[model samples]
Target chain A: MILPRLVFESLLNRRSTIVLTLITIAFSVALLLGVEKVRQDTRYSFSNTVSGTDLIVGARSGNLPLLLYSVFHIGNASNNISWQSYQHIRKNKKVAWSIPISLGDSHRGFRVLGTNSDYFKFYRHGNKQQLDFEHGKPFAALFDVVIGADVAKKLNYTLGKKIILSHGVGKVSFSDHDDKPFAVVGILKKTGTPVDRTVHVSLQAIEAIHLDWQTGYKNPAHAVSAKQALKLELEPKTITAFMLGLTSRLSVFSLQRSINQYSKEPLLAVLPGATLQELWSLFGLAESALLIITVFVVLSGLLGMLTAILASLNERRRELAILRSVGARPWHILVMLCAEAGLLTAGGIFVGVALYYLIIIAAAPVVETRYGLTLTLTGLSINNVCMLLITQVAGILIGLIPGIRAYRMALNNGITIRL
Target chain B: MKNQFISIVMLMVLTACEEPVNSESLQATWEDLIQEGFTPKELILKYQIDTYEADDPRRMQLIRAMEEEWNSAPVNENLDNKKITLTGFIVPLEIESNAAYPTVSEFLLVPFLGACIHVPPPPANQLVYVKMESPIAMPNDGEAFSVTGIMKTESVNNELAEAGYNMKGLSLETFSNESLNPNTE
Candidate 1:
């Protein structure tokens, strides 16, 4: 009891210095935890975006670029694969299902994806979870469109709301497909992926809107009305990319090899998992660098506390000597110093955890909306708890330095004021 | 001092809770996976593979026959449902989402490095589809792992049918040269 009182009184005497050291420790702990959380959540968000699909096939391009453009909607495809080639490949006996997607269109900054009903039936994300409808069903009519949760929320679209798409993939487009407007029939539930930023319609609808824009601009002389265009042939000539689900997982590599070696066209087939692993390998160095820096920040914070305590030992030698003359054991002095360190470390950790939650609560929504990465709000993970424990242990060990020094001085100069 | 002792004991208990490697697991070599007396080199020689021109129709027939033989190759029934440890390179089948690292949950364990990308893949007997109990960080290309699991002789068939062994992986460890030549022990 006396040890704790003595430790508290001593800390209060050095309140200003102690408070600054506490803040340094708290901030470093918060930074370390924050970096770890962001790294984990980013990986989680990206990985959960696409699943169950065995392969993503596109016109000859790098695997990472194809994955980004086709699945994540982060970039544009280099070229389009001929519809004939897609049809021929889908005819293979090993293909369980296929979903072809056509890009290069936008509606109010959101990408417009052209696909058939197979997109809803076969596409999966996050542990084989199927996409569920929030409001309506899949697109039934040729001109009926389906919007994702984010697009619907941001744009304030509802069932039967008519919206026209732009010809090019940009926030603001010069050419709008005003002649052919699509009615929103379905709204998908929030997936926390790029799917929430997509507008989906049938391949025919995509072709219909571009009927008069063959030469990259509207040809008014030969323009077809929306009603007339619906009656004409609307088979898609090309598709940006397609996803494939194989009948057997074992055939994936062999099928990918065949597709890559296809004599008729230059194409690339990549396993989504393998390509994702490759992408993470590219970021592995950066992620490790961030973690290492945060660790050093934590080390410096502890070192600061050490430096302050060691410097204060000189001034406190008289106080310790007087206590020794009053029959205080040398071990009692040691325990008091240890107790002070333990309290500061525990307090710093508590404040740091509170601060971490405060920052996460404020930034989660912004991160989700801006990057499509959801920051999950949960209790501290096991890893975080372990790290905090290790930090506390380190803090106590640092206390032993000042503790032993004071013990030696109290024994040598009992009741003597050593200036 | 008593509290310190208790915390140390608690740590020991926590570590002890992890699943231990089964002591009864049989060490299996890649050769044990293949059908007895069937060699790829001998098969190629018997089919006169080197003599055929690139466009020869007979060569195509021989290739098809070889594929059929490879698919139909029987797995060792003695090893079925037995706890076994085998070392091989990995070809990831399923990767877990939301992981800070690229962790693989399901993968194919092949007898040779580059088996997935190379022109010729191992036969059905030589391929083991491993489903891990927990995901592991993705290993570098050509890195080998010693996997312990219960081996099952299962045929996965679709329109284009394929047959291979399945393994419910219990544990995985990095394979070293010491594991290859156990006589050194």
Candidate 2:
């Protein structure tokens, strides 16, 4: 009981240094937990990007690249599948539904996908949830287009707004499809998937906009007004990739086999789930590295506290001598020093958890829109509880360092008149 | 070259002379086939919608049953050689024309909204093989249209599927949005 009062008085004597120590530990704790939270949320959102799709088919390419282009819209396809191949596969008896995606255009860094009205009816994300319309309806005409939630919000686009697309997938491109601008007809609700960053147009419009170009040059003779182009055939010659949903869930492998062995063209069909698992396995190495780095950072923060407490021990020598005169033992001095360290660590943890929530609330919107990651405000997990306990234990171990130093000082120094 | 052009025009004019049966007098003669133990519900399950993974045992069983039923379905002989006007979604199987003007000449008419594109192709009986003499322009993607033609109870196999019925289509026109999907009829 007396030891508690002594510990409190000793900490109060050095309140400024103790407060600084608390702040440092709190910052470290926040960083460590923040990394863990972001990692979990990233995995959740990425895996949830495509659900209803069984296979993502594309022209023969690497599995990761195909997934990147078809699902994430991160990169361009190496090759394009012939429209005939898409039709043949789309019409397969085993294929319940297929949405052909023709990429290669962008509007302000966001990918532009050319598809049909069936996309609105069949495309799903986040555990088979169909897309909902925040405002307006699906594209009805060739020039009508639908913008994703992030696109609508970031670009400030609304219904009846006209937007032009660039011919290439660069952040900025000189060649623009300004002649055939599309009007935004629909804006989908936020999905926290790559779909949120896409701009959708009719497949015919994709063809219509490119009618004037042949071999990367705009031929003046082929140049026609949007109305005139509509009169001509708008069948797509090639598409970047397509996703297929089978009628029978048991026929997925068989259909994937058939698509892989397709006689018309060289094609590749990857099961989205399996490919995603493989991708995550590759990323596991980087994730562990990040975890290890954060852990070391936390350890260093605790060491800083130990250093602060040890430095203050020099000035507390006289205080300890005076306590010794008042009948305090060596162990009492040790307990008082350890108690102060424990109090600072516990206070730091409390503040750290509060700060973590504050940072998450502030950054959730930016993270969701920028990275397509949904940082759900989940409660402390079992692992996190274990982590907190470990952090507290580490603090106690660090506290022992200064505790031993003060114990030795109190034992060696007497209540004599020596400086 | 001029002579070839004139001959092609003459052939087109002759083929276009046949009149489609008036919609008022024409009746779907194959409507009886649908009544004979034919419900799309039995062939498909509600849980199977929008799923593509081939891991469900129930889905496999249902698909096998669908294929079996499709093979055993009896075609109506009365529907053969009859002129009718049918509305359904078009899946372009073949586009034919000179380089200057391309039009869809051979296509499949499906009975549902997303039959050929979004969903698995419907059973063979539900699909109508259409061959047009004067190919019409391809309509909007997955848009249903009315095809007036002489229906034939012919089985034709393509890379896509085996179509149970064929039609010699004469004219094609866009369907009014409300008139599509003769699910009731």
Candidate 3:
């Protein structure tokens, strides 16, 4: 008790320096934990975007690019699969269900996905969860569109609202399809996926809107009214990609091989789970690099504490000599120094964790809205607890440096004021 | 007091020398999982399946007959409900997509690696569907693991219908070269 009191009083004597060291450690700790949390959540949200589908088929392209463009809406597909090939593949007995996706249009900044009602029925995400309607129902008429949660909220769209789509996938486009506007028939619930930022319309509506733009430009002479365009054949000729659910998972490899070998048109098929793992492994390199850098930041923080303690030892030599004269032992001084380090580390960890929660609470919504990544407020996982334990032990181990030096000084100058 | 201390140390050493009595005793190999009196090679030989040319119409009939024999091949019932350890490569069935690391809770344990991609997967009886209580970091491709569990002869007719055996895995360890010939000792 007396030794702890002396250590506490000693720490208080240099309050400013100790507090500064603690703040450095706290900031470093918070940064380390924040990076790890965001990395974990990003991977989680990425993987949760699509599930239960066995294969994603698209025009011949790299698997990663196809996955990114079709599922994540991150890029454009290199080419479109002919509607004939999609029909032929979906007709195979092994295919349980298929959902065709046509891209290359946008409303405001959101990508417009042209698909049939089968998407609402068969498409799954995040543990096979089905998309539920937040308001209204799936599109019943050809001109009716279903907006995702983000589009509805960001654009302030309601049921029966009229919105026109652009000719291409850009925020600002000159070729606006002002001739044919879609009615918002439904809004999907928040899914924390790219689906939340998409605008869904029927395939026929896509064809209708692009009727006059067949020559890559809307000709004034050939302009067709929206009502007249509906009377024409609105069958889609090509699609960006399509997802397949096989009757049996055992046939996935076989079907994928056959799709890749389709002689009529060059095509590519990839198993979603396997491709996702491959994609994540690529990101794993960058994730590890970030973690390593943050770890070094923490190491430097601990080293700063060590330097502060070691520098203070020179000024505390007289203090130790006085204590020795008052009958304090060398080991007592050692344990007291270690205890002080332990206290600073523990205090820093507590404030760091509190600061971590504060940042998460303040930034989670912004992260979710801006990046579509959900930052879950989970309790300290086993990995976190282990890291904190290692940091605390390192701090105490660092204390041993100054501890042994002070021990030597106390023994060498017993009962002498060397200052 | 010195004698007592030496005797206590000796007792500890003796106890440490004794091997632990493991509850699981049956060490099932790929050969043991096969149904008695049934072999794909024997069927192929008996039907002259390899003798016909690829374009021959008779060859398709013989191949279909061989497939029927393969599909109807039953699991070895004697090993049912037995506590056993089997070593094999994994084919993940239930991937936890949200994990930072690739994690799987359910997977198929096949006798050989690359069974999923390679043509003509192993017989149904040779594939064991293993379900772990919790998800574990998925092993790299072609890596093998030895799983200890209670084996069942029941069929799992889920999306992955290739499995002829189901196992409630209790524990697992990475298969090493030393464990390759487990019965040698």
Candidate 4:
């Protein structure tokens, strides 16, 4: 309406001042939107870490640690469940599917998971979606390997490539399984989870490679050669734990109770969702810290906006009085003033989203290779939509005080003979 | 009143087919036994110290010595027939590079042994994959425990013929059974 023209005219007349105000509003919008996008993406990434998993059963340990080791691939497990216990739990009628995991091995810095083909068939990420193959297929016929997307790309692996494993779980591996090289059979599609950085092979593969080793060193006196070692049986005696899925969700608790209370052994069963929540609980302090930082940033932006606008408004008294003398309504002045805030905020939001999308696209490879977390450029998640709406509402509300003052100024000027 | 009547009817319908078990207490749901004193080891089989931290010599010494007991012979169900208490972490089993066979969800309990950060690495055979039918709460504090359970070992495998513990009938774990299901609420 008339307010937009008035607002534009005011902006044109004082181009430099309005532009500065607009810039400030734009930065605020960018910060708010950018932070919101990151938060939403973080939650999205976390939820997708272990998709398609019905349950992650492990030793009776803290949920976060279990998740930290199993899903996020951070840290290591403190205790191990007895191999005997794993077999008994797997026999339950409710367990329709399961995949055993063995950790504490690494190739270079990437984690080495001693698993089987069941992992390739049943394991999923990114919202219960099955793992898609980028190149090749699941590892089979023993000593064959499957690399994650990030691993293959970073290491520049091709089909039927050979790689060595280390005795330890990190970059500085002591004993390299140089003798028992593995062939790459498959490369997984990008999963946006920790699986991307992982190097997976059969449990038998892990054992076959390590058979001649003892305490990270081969016995100098006598040893079977790698080919000779192959002749020896390579079935694994122990593993880390397994993920399970059941036909009925209701039977989970009963099945869980059965495992924990099985008179024959000491076993712990866990639900993946509950453990993840418990793990995030310990991260509450970090979340609080982030919230505090965000609050300060928002307050600073608002304070800067308030000071800049008020300073400009004080100097525009004569213009306001002229409008009042010209028979313009006070409400019109109010609308004109607040409209500037809305416009500037909108512009800011546009720029911030553009920047984030650009960054996500540019840094995709870097983030993937390093953290094994994939960042998608899909704009405006549901949470982001809600956030933007909230931000716009907040911007408008903050503009109201300045609007009312402009209205009062117009009213006072009407009788001052300024016309 | 109409709303209340409908809500009650809906709740009843949901619970209609389920039978309640009142025989066992909730405490029994978590624990089946309490362990007694450790049976004194004869000469405490000699072991080398693969110590991670030097601060706790007692724990390190005990675990180092116990490593022999862990790896020396297969866990015998009839040994001592005396309730023995042992405290350590329930860690995930490491991938054994060479085994006759292995099964799913395999693991092994180590007595305060180090993780990736502390120790060099656990031997493959010492590792075990854990499985529990029921979900238990995981621990936040890194405290070891006094767990009591009859230990057993057996060969098992999937279609691929992996072998490991036949850990079916293990009893109540203090913690570590968390669920991954999204809470409906």
Candidate 5:
């Protein structure tokens, strides 16, 4: 009963040094937990980018590159699938519906996706969740565009706002589509996917924007005004890739097979989930490395606590000698020191958990906008709980070091020890 | 009791007097043919490539050319325009676009289960394109069914695969053990 009282009073006596140690441990714990949350959430966000589609068909290329360019709006396609090929696949009796994605253009720095109404009708993400509008409706006119939540928030776009897109995918644009500026007709609710950073427009709008430009050059002789271009038939000659939803899940392989062996143009079809698994395998090494680094950080924090306790053990020899004079055994001294270390660690963990929530709440908006990560305020997952338990066990082990030292000092420093 | 009896008699008389239209079409027997002979695996074996790499443009080019050549590969001509009933697994191609409850209208009937789920699909001769008059709700694509249809040895080239035979489906029902029995010689 008195053991805890003694330990608490002793810790309170050296509150400054103990507080410093607590802060260090708390910060380290927060860092570790934060890293884990980001890693898990990042994977969840990436995998949940596209769903309800059976196959992601693109030009013949590596699966990862195709996935990156088509779904993530990252990098660029080496070749585009011809419009005829897209039409052919769309008309296939097996396909329930399809969304033809025409990428390459960018509004400011965000990716511009040229698609038809089918994109809004059939496109799904994050476990078959449909795209819901935050404001206004989908792009109905040729010049109307739908901005994503991140895009609208970042660029401060409101409905009916005017914006121009650049021809290429690069951040730095040499030429812009100044002739035909699109009006923001819609803003989509955030999905925590790359879709949140995209700008959606009609397929014909893409063709109209490029009518004045030819092969990356603005030709004055072939200049077509936006009004004149609108009057002409603006059919997209090619597309970046497309996503297909098949009627039967079993026909996915057959349809994928058919798309792959599509004789008209060499095309490749990949199951999104299967290709995503392949992507994870490629990224597995980096994920493991991140976990290892966080583990080391946690170990260093525990070591810091051990150092603080062991250093304080030297100054407390006289107090231990006094306790020995009063008939307290060497094992009691051991228990007191261990208890103090354990209490400090438990307190630090509590503070760390509190700090983690604070930082997450504060940084949620910035993280989502900058990294497209949706940090949910969830309780400690199974893996995290195990990590915490492991940390506590290691703390107990670390406490043993100073505990044994205090035990040996109590026996050596008899009651009549000369100061 | 008398009123109920009279009403039942009048209903029977009315139903009996009605001429049964399309009775011949519904009652006609179909010739039972073995599906094993449709796709000769030996013919496809010769045309198979070792592996197809994504990076190699030439491999895909060769595959495209090989696929064209494979389309001309010999197929059974006797199955053309014959009223035939065959039991096989379905690989749906077109479905009604009801997100809640979808039904398959166009599908490719394959002899084996899971012909196109994961592994490479069978050759053109092994595949039969079947289009039903009305879409039927298939519990799953892997479930086998018996399709009675007019089979024509017409080569169908869709973006996904090529089928050597096409069938205009007349009726379809889930496969039963008794379906394997030859109904007609």
Candidate 6:
């Protein structure tokens, strides 16, 4: 203990250099730990997005894409399912209810989902069912709109507010759907899902806006006003896809089979749970990679700390010998040095964790918008606590080399050259 | 050190025995399953809609599950050729040229087999969209009997998920056209 006190004081005397090194090591540890925490928490948030829904039926596509467009409000469906196909599947005895969806349109950067009220009625996610209202209710009439939690907050919208649909997604939206301006009817609570950032409208609205427009984009040469569009037939001929639920649980397979085998359309049915499981397996590889990266980073930080202290051993030899001559035991000196190294590592990790929380609080909105990932600044996890312990132990073990050398040199020097 | 090594070996052994969630139904060819006494109910729960078009609370759960099953299958493209029964809806894709179902002809098969999006190789939980020669109309709660074709993966079009494992081609046969299986319950 005495030796460690002396060493801490000695390092303190060269406070400028030592403090710089300590800050560097602390930030590195923070980076390492931050990476690990973000990786784990993001995964948890992702996996917990939709828990209650039993199935996620969509056009035959990659599981990730299907999930993305349907639930997350990211990307666009490759094709649309025929109304005929959706109707046939919906009529199946096994189907409970259906939520018909028409995707591939956007209002500003927010995605516009062309879906029926059944989406609000029958949809379930995370721990709860039904979309909770942050301000208002679901759109009751056609041409009405319902904004997500983020959309509402970011745009500062209220009930009955009118907004136009942008032709494209992101900052630079091309031709606007000025003719079919939708009134904000609902504001959904923050679910930390993509829905929070989306603009929900009836399937009719989707068809109404695109009645005269061609695929990809409308001909800018023949742009029509919103009032003029009202007079035209806004009936939608095609939609991105439809979500089907069977009346009876047993009939889902038969219904899916029916849909897939449709003679008129090349279609597919998918169970959300099954595909989610599959997608998770695919992500498992990334998880392993993340684990490896985190391990390497943490190891590197510990090694750097060890290297710095060990390099300073030569300067500390005289101090150790002086202590030995003053009746300090060699073993005691070793313990003190190891303790100080351990304390430094533990202290650095602590600061790193604190910094991560601060960053999360600051960048929550940015992460939500760009990456579509929702992060919560919570307390330390058991895993993180374990990491702290591991850091402490590693610090002590690495310092052992220098600690032993100092002890040996002190014993050899004896009272003759205590200085 | 020796004890530590043994513990690690034991942990590895235990972890390796975990069961994968692949469909455990009879491994019949895609045609055989369709032709046989098809049980739609059992298959529906196993192969439901994959509302993973967007990253919502609903889709995230599906993505996680799909990722879990991506490792076992090396087959990604040409899903119809795999000779396994798939349960899904009739979704017309946007790729049909002069087909019966024009707009929604090229579609995906989800849930049971999700082609991974961002994940490198597509998850086996999805099947990529493919075009059939003739447009296949869906019977209300219908079932088809046909010999699925072989695998074909290409980097031509942007698919449902982000990347990896896109469906290329398929052969759709109407059930009324043939009696591959004679015996009926």
lDDT of 2 by residue, B115-165 (tens): 233344345566677778777764555566878787767444454333357
Over A256-325, each residue of candidate 4 has an lDDT whose tens digit, in order, gives 6666567765556766654554454566567668756765665565556556667788777777777777
Clashing pairs in 2: A96-B119, A96-B120, A97-B118, A249-B53, A249-B54, A250-B54
Weakest 10 consecutive residues of candidate 4 chain A by summed lDDT: A247-256
Name the best candidate (by DockQ).
Answer: 1
> What lDDT score belongs to each candidate, Candidate 1 first?
0.84, 0.77, 0.83, 0.61, 0.76, 0.61
Find the 10 residues in a row with the least total lDDT in model 6 chain A. Answer: A245-254
Deviation in angstroms for A68 in model 5? Answer: 1.3
Using lDDT, give the best candidate's number. 1
Please rank every candidate by lDDT, starting with the best: 1, 3, 2, 5, 6, 4
lDDT of 2 by residue, A11-59 (tens): 7778887888888889888888898887777666666677757789999
Alpha-carbon runs more than 4 Å astray in model 4: A51-54, A126-128, A172-174, A216-223, A247-249, A262-266, A280-296, A324-331, A363-365, A381-383, A404-419, B1-185
Which has the better lDDT: candidate 4, or candidate 5? 5
Q: Output the better candidate (2/4) by lDDT.
A: 2
Worst 10 residues of 3 chain A by lDDT: A246-255
| Per-residue alpha-carbon lDDT of candidate 5 for residues B93-125, written as tens digits (9 for 90 to 100) | 444432222345677676675334554665555
Better of 2 and 3 by TM-score: 3
Task: List each candidate's DockQ score.
Answer: 0.27, 0.01, 0.15, 0.02, 0.06, 0.02
User: Per candidate, chain B TM-score?
Assistant: 0.65, 0.60, 0.67, 0.32, 0.53, 0.32
What DockQ would candidate 1 receive versus the native complex?
A: 0.27
Clashing pairs in 5: A93-B93, A93-B94, A94-B93, A94-B94, A258-B160
Give RMSD to native, each candidate.
Answer: 8.6, 21.7, 9.6, 14.9, 12.8, 18.0
Q: Which candidate, 2 or 3, would have the higher DockQ against the true structure?
A: 3
The residue-by-residue lDDT of candidate 3 on B64-106, one tens digit each, is 8878787668888887767789988776656776555447776
Look at candidate 3 and give me any clashing residue pairs: none
Q: What docking grade applies to model 6?
A: incorrect
Q: Cα RMSD (Å) between model 3 and the true structure?
A: 9.6
* Fraction of native contacts under 8 Å reproduced by each candidate: 0.33, 0.00, 0.11, 0.00, 0.08, 0.00
Name model 5 segments beyond 4 Å from true: A172-174, B1-185
